[model samples]
Target: MIKSKKLMYQIIAVISLGLAIFGVITPGFPATEFVLLCAWSSAKGSPKIHHFLHANRFTGPVLNDWRNGKVISLNNKIFSSISMLLCVCFLFYSGLNIYFIGFGLFGISISFIWVWSRPSHV
Candidate 1:
């Protein structure tokens, strides 16, 4: 039963990631939610995948750091920060004024900071 649940979670994570990836080219699409969902689901679903993510050469450091409860990688942290910055830029550029998006960006930024700041052994 546990294995089945894990498998289902893995499937959900993969599907969510796929959708997030596809959203990349779709206008007005938000992929971050799906990516986050994938991360969360995988973290709870399978230790193997979690370990793989933790040890991944490109993303492992961040994953492991997250698992250990440490700060996110400088690269991911910078990337996230820049993304939020771009959201602000886009908001200003469009002049349409969707201020709520800023809140989401801010929230995500805070989440990253919180996770990264956790002890490096979580």
Candidate 2:
């Protein structure tokens, strides 16, 4: 990759990783998704960063399972599902537009099904 493209990808990876970290600290944020995004972009932009994420104790297993078989462990499924549900609940009570609530609920329901549908890493 050209220097500019490399820098762009690196920036994306760092931003995603930052968001993933923030998700860890904040409730109802999807950390794993951002982590996966960081891994992918880092793989393209910076092998060292990819290796670091894959070697980290907290992140390695999830990355390996995903890379190997697109697996989502049952524990992770439960955690993510609950988080998503909580977000929807907040949306329902946020007094936002009915359409916004409906859209959020619909999206969460689809995502919930999709996440639960993934094969577990047995």
Report lDDT per candidate. Answer: 0.61, 0.88
Q: Which residue pairs does candidate 2 place in steric collision? A: none
Prediction RMSDs, each to the true structure: 5.0, 1.6
lDDT per residue for candidate 2 within 1-122, as digits (tens), equals 59999999899999999999998776567788899999999998999889999999989999999988899899888889888878877897799999988888887788788788889974
Against the true structure, candidate 2 has what lDDT?
Answer: 0.88
Q: In candidate 1, which residue ranges exceed 4 Å CA deviation?
A: 1-4, 19-40, 43-48, 97-122
- Tens digits of per-residue lDDT for model 1 on 5-121? 888999887887677666454533445455556667888886665565456564455545554644455655555556556655665577564667676557656756654564433
| Model 1, residue pairs in steric clash | 67-122, 68-120, 68-121, 68-122, 69-118, 69-119, 69-122, 70-116, 71-116, 72-116
Please give the range of 10 consecutive residues that has the lowest summed lDDT in model 2. 23-32
Winning candidate number (lDDT): 2
